[model samples]
Target: MKEAENIFLNLINQHKGIIHKISKMYMKDAEEQRDLFQEIVLQLWKAYPTFKGNSKFTTWMYRVCLNTALIYFKKDNRKVDKAPLDENIDIMDVNENEGKEEKLAYLYTAVQELNAIEKALIFLFLENQSHRDIAENLGISEVNARVKLNRTKEKLQFIIKKNGYEF
Candidate 1:
């Protein structure tokens, strides 16, 4: 049991960036993001035993985290008020350019306007996942992933532009 726990903790620490990204993509508030993050970890732990290692850990992680976020959002019906970026969010990039940070902030804000599946599409796209991978993760067809991703990008751009921010 201890060995399993240790391995799980190590894997989580190694791939925590994935969790951070998923939580932030789903939630706008720092506190809410943290809560969602915890919930994802809990879900992951519970489902860990079912991992048969037939696929990459990350693939499994993404499915669990995304499902958790979608369900969490529905269960809570959360509506986040537009608040300034919290210093606590792990948004600090290696580039550290203020302009880039501001741009990213606007992007995140615009992303909040997206539906859950749309947000997942954008998130997977930004992560450089191919349509096939996105489809596999989302349990959809590859062609559907590509079509939805293209449409989601168009919608996200419209949302940002509508919010008075230029690309």
Candidate 2:
């Protein structure tokens, strides 16, 4: 039991960024993000014993993390208010320059406008996951994943432009 616990801790520690990224992608506010992160961790812990080693640990973690994010809204329907545009949260790696930081924040703001599935697809795409991997994670055909990814990117671009961002 102790050894299993240690392995799980190590795995989570190594891939904690997935939790942060998925939580940030799904939840807007800091508090909701924290709550969702904890929820994902708890779900992962509960599902850890059932892990059969058929996939990479990170793959399994993605499944668990994305599942939690997908269902999180079903449990809570309150319209959580988003933070203002000027105060950008450090959800992802930001540039040292103020201009780049604000641009990334604007990108995130555009992302927040996306639907739940669109957000997941974009997040996986940004992670550089192959189309097959994205499809597998998303339980869709690779062609469908490709189509959606392209459409999602166009939609995101439109959203960003509508927000008055040139790039």
What's the CA RMSD for each of the models?
Answer: 7.0, 6.4
Scored against the true structure, residue 132 in model 2 reaches a CA lDDT of: 97
Error of 2 at 51 (Å): 1.3
Give the count of colliding residue pairs in each prediction: 0, 0
What digit string (tens of lDDT, one per residue) describes model 2 on residues 1-167? 99999999999999998898888888789999999999999999999999999998888888889888989965687343332232211223344476787876786777888777878887887787999999999999999888877777777776676778754
In terms of lDDT, the poorest run of 10 residues in model 2 is: 83-92
Q: How close is candidate 1 to the true structure, as a TM-score?
A: 0.86
What root-mean-square deviation over C-alphas does model 1 reach?
7.0
TM-score of each: 0.86, 0.85
Best by TM-score: 1
Please identify model 1 stretches exceeding 4 Å from their true place: 78-98
Model 1: how far residue 123 lies from native, Å = 0.9
- Compose the digit string of candidate 1's lDDT tens values, residues 1-167: 99999999999999999889888888889999999999999999999999999999988988898899989987897663332221211212324475887888888888898778877887787777889999999999998888777777777766676798774
Which lDDT value does model 1 have at 33? 97
